[model samples]
Target: MELKQIIQNRRSVFPDQYNSKPISKQVIMELLEAANWAPTHKRTEPWRFKVLEGETKINLGVFLAEKFKETADKFSEFKYNKIKRNSKNAGAIIAICMERDPEESIPEWEEVAATAMAVQNMWLTATDLGLGAYWSSPGLIASIGEFFTLKPNEKCLGFLFLGYYDGPNPERTPNPIEDKVEWL
Candidate 1:
């Protein structure tokens, strides 16, 4: 697929759309390679991806479910079940992170922007590969750094859930750019 079409066609495919088939390690490596090429200011290269698959994904589900149970005043069984289901259903879950520069030379936001670009690259690659993918930001995501054994300067941004999907590619209708953009 062409780059323009890939960018416009990319959609947030949820776990329910995912099939049970596993994704090959080579494809995941290609996605990471694409992410690694995203531009970073001052060469900070802040993006860090921690991938979870197989039994480890179940462990992630357990960890998240337990965290939600502890935090919610009245834990909704529905939400808890969905979290557990999504984690196990996904072929893989990649934890997106940003390791801040200790020197603090470049602004913190730049590092975040760089990380986002990296994710965008991954997303586009997934779309091209006919894989379903979505970036999810749960309320308890920030606390994942501890579970992932991240350094003090590193922070979890979100998780990219990936899996094989069947059926025709979904179409997207985006809002016009005029409303959101302005000429100087």
Candidate 2:
């Protein structure tokens, strides 16, 4: 597919739409390679990925459900069950993290922006490969570092859920770009 179409057609495909088939490790590597190529100021390369597959994915589900239960003032069984079910069903879960520069030479927001760009690259590549992908930023995501044992400077941004799907790709109707852009 052409780059323009790929960008325009990219949609958040949910885990429920994914089929039961497993995604090849080689394909996942390609997606990571694409993410690696995203532009970063001063070559900081702050973005980091923790891939959870097979049994690890199951553990992630349990962790997320338990975290939600512990954090919520009034936990709903429905929400807890949904979170667990989705994590268990996903083909893979990638924990997106940003490793802050120890010296603090550059602003932290720049590092986050660079990480987001990296995720965008991965998303586009997933679209090209006909794989279902979605970036989820739940409130409990901030506490992921505790369970994942992330380094002191490393902070969890969110997670990218991935899988294979044969369902219809939903069409997106974005508002006019002109409204958001300003003349120089």
Candidate 3:
């Protein structure tokens, strides 16, 4: 498919049929390569990713579940279990982290924006490959100092789950952009 068409068609899919089938490492590498091409401020590419699969994905699910159980005062057991279960449903999960460029002296927000662009690149690549993907940010992901272990000044942005579609993409009716544009 053309890149432009893929970009327009990519959708965040969460459905009931996702199984344990695994995506090959080569495809995952291609996704990262696409992300590596994203534009960044002052060429300070700040996106960091940890791809979790096999046993590691299970461990991550358990870790997130336990962290929520420990830290969320009002945590629902159902939600915790759902996260654990769904984490295993995807073929793989990519942990997205962002590190600010200390030498560049740019505003932190720019780095975050660049990181988002990186994720979009990855998502588009997945779409072109007919892979299912979604980006999710639980509250704990943003607070790297909390449940996740990170180097100084590093922050967890979110995780992207990728797999072959278990079912058809849901019908999407995007909100009309008539009220979302401006012309000077």
Candidate 4:
């Protein structure tokens, strides 16, 4: 497919939409490789990905469910159940992290933007490969360090929940680009 077509077709397919079939490691590697090519300012290359699969995925679900139960000021049982179920349902979860430049050579926001572009690349690749994916940034990621080890310079950005789904998701219609543009 063409680039424009791939871009237009790329949509956030959620956990409930994902079938039970597992996406192979090699395919996941392909997406990661595409992520590696994302443009970086000053070559900081700040994105780091940790792949969670099988029992690890289930463990992550349990961790998030328990943490949400303990921390949310107004948590719902429905939300808690969904949080736990989502992780275990995924074919894989990529913990997206950003490693700050040790010397602080660049502004922090630049590093963050670069990391996001990296995820965008992976998302596009997944779409092209006929796989489903979505980036989920739950409030509880602030506490993820408790569940997973991290370097002093590293922090959790979010999780990329990816899998293979069997059908179409609801359509997302974007507003016209012209409406947001300004000419001086």
Name the candidate that leads on TM-score: 4
lDDT of 1 by residue, 62-85 (tens): 889889998988999999988999
Better model by lDDT: candidate 1 vs candidate 2: 1
Tell me the number of clashing residue pairs for each predicted model: 0, 0, 0, 0
| Model 3 pairs whose backbones collide | none
Q: How do all models score by TM-score?
A: 0.96, 0.96, 0.91, 0.98
Ranking by lDDT: 4, 1, 2, 3
Off by over 4 Å in 3: 15-17, 142-149
Question: Candidate 4, residues 53-152: lDDT per residue as tens digits?
Answer: 9999999999999999999899899999999899988999999999999988999999999999999999999999989999999889999999999999
- For this target, which candidate reaches the highest lDDT against the unseen true structure? 4
Query: Candidate 3 on 94-142: residue-level lDDT in tens?
Result: 9899987977578899999999999999999888887888888988675
lDDT of each model, Cα atoms only?
A: 0.92, 0.91, 0.83, 0.94
Steric clash pairs (candidate 2): none
Error of 2 at 51 (Å): 0.5
Error of 4 at 107 (Å): 0.7
Candidate 4 backbone overlaps, count: 0
Pick the winner on lDDT between candidates 3 and 4.
4
